[model samples]
Target: MKLNHSVTGQDQGLPIMLVHGLFGQGRNLGAIARRLSEQRRVILVDQRNHGDSPHDPDHSYAAMAGDLAEVIGAFGGRVDLAGHSMGGKAAMHLALTQPELIRKLAVMDIAPVAYAHSQNHLVDAMAAMDLQGVVRRSEADRRLSEHIHDTGLRAFLLQSLDLKSDPPRWRLNLPALRDWMDRTTGWPEGLPKGIFDGPALFMAGAESDYVDDAGEAAIREYFPQARLLRIKHAGHWMHADAPEAVAETLSAFMGGG
Candidate 1:
């Protein structure tokens, strides 16, 4: 499927693609995309079932990677890819399977291992809501807060809630995403090991346990040339917590420094 995307910057140099985390659209990373687009082209993609991308029942790593591959094939022969959370897993899979299409890989705050914790409640809360009667964003948010107490997370997730639509529908395919929570949260099985040996950067959040000492073993096994860096004072949402630092690190990693 042709994924929805935004392109910025010049046609010169190796282009960079920014893949947002779960429940995010391409425009969610507009700040980071604009910052990175200064010297080179930047492509912000909405993964399948998120944003304006097509919704499919298959929401696995392989399928997401295939979507990224298609984007790379269309935008450039190869691209420098950076992804956050769920998007990071897709980047890793694409880099591993189609190494030639990715010049460099950057995975932010997530490893290739399956996460023990599940975000099923987040999905379920979204899926449970019927936004047809919701007249205002605040009302929707207030109702959502009954299920999801976190204000910041509700704000982020609500970006995909199309309040401007006639009936105020959710831009995200909540049912399809909710159904594949297991595969979305965990790393896919049956993939070959350490297929990507190119320069790799794993930017972790100092405040997040997504990348721990226990996870390093698996990181090394999959990406032998990978280097890990921590964004101080940031959590899983490092870009939001430390936008400047994240952008700076991204620029340096992509050799724009």
Candidate 2:
């Protein structure tokens, strides 16, 4: 599959790829990439079934990992990788499956263990929107508010909604994503064996339950060199909540500072 991506700082230094979570596109990390662009080549990728990437009914960590591998290969061998939530899991799988293709790995606010399907409400809310009759983004926002309580989350999800001049179209493949919510949330079982010895950083939001004691063993099993860092007062979206901290940590890690 030809993965969709936006490249920044291409001529600066070593390449670093940014992968976003579920319901997120490459641009979600635009800020971080721009900040890091001063010293590194940043590649923000939109994983399959999301953003402008090709949509397929099958969405799994293995498939997503394969997609990432292809992107890395296109970059001329290995590159540093950073991912959040769902993207974090896929990054881990990719590093483990193709260790030689990843220079360094950073996983934000997500564990390697299998996550239970908890985003069903969000999926249902997104699916319930009357896309056909929706006249404006505000109208869609108003209707979505009934099902989604968090105004911020509603706005974040709605970022996928793009209005084209030619008859207006929704860029995201909502139905396909909604139908494979389980696959998107689930973890791949079993590994080929051994660990990815490359330097790895496991960043967790202080207030997020995504990375807890329960998932530590699984993380260590695959990424034995992984080091954990917690950003204060942040939730699942640590990068958005604490951009400065994330940028500092990432810059240091990638630059070997």
Candidate 3:
């Protein structure tokens, strides 16, 4: 599917594509994109089933990676790809399956291994939300609060709420996400055995357990040239917690330095 995307910066060398995580849109990485765009073109992509992208029943990493491949080919044959969380996994899968499409790969706060955590609760909360007579984001927030206590996370999810659409509705495909929860948090079986020997960056948040020892091992197994780094005082969403650091580090990784 042709995913929704926005491009900035000059048509210089290979573009840098930024992909967001679950429950996030491309604009979530706007800060990083802005910094990188100064040196090269940046493609902010709304992965399928999120943002303005077309939603499909399949949300597997392979499918997601395929969607990204389409976007990359449309912009240019090759790109320097960076993705956070779910987007990071998709980026890795693309690089593994089709290395020619990627000039460099950056995986932020994620590993190529399956995670035990389940985001079904968030999907359930969003699915159970009563949009009836709710005209304001606050009202929706108030209802979602019963299930989700994290104020920041609730606010983040609320970004996808379409308030102008008559009675209002979430732009996310909650059912598809919930149904495909396992695949969303899993690494596809029988992946390509070969490694992506291109320049790779595996950045983890110091406070985040997303990329643990096992994750680091997996990184080296698949990307021998991978450079590992950790952002201080940042959690899983390092881009938000330390936008400047994330942006600067990513800019340098993509050769913006």
Score every model by TM-score: 0.97, 0.93, 0.97
Task: Count the clashes in each prediction.
Answer: 0, 0, 0
Candidate 1 is scored at a TM of 0.97
- Reference-based lDDT, each prediction: 0.89, 0.83, 0.91
* Candidate 1: tens digits of C-alpha lDDT, residues 80-182: 9999999999999898788999888999999988888878888889878878788888999998998999999999999899887888888888887887878
* Candidate 1 to native Cα RMSD, angstroms: 1.3
Candidate 2: residue 177 Cα off by (Å):
2.5
Give me the overall lDDT of model 3. Answer: 0.91
Candidate 3 residue pairs that clash = none
lDDT of 2 by residue, 1-257 (tens): 88999888856545999999988999999888988887888999998878899988777788899999898888887899999998998898888888898888999999877777567777777777666766678887888898998989988998887654243445667777777777677677777535688889999999888888977777777777889999887899988899888888888888831
Ranked by TM-score, top first = 3, 1, 2
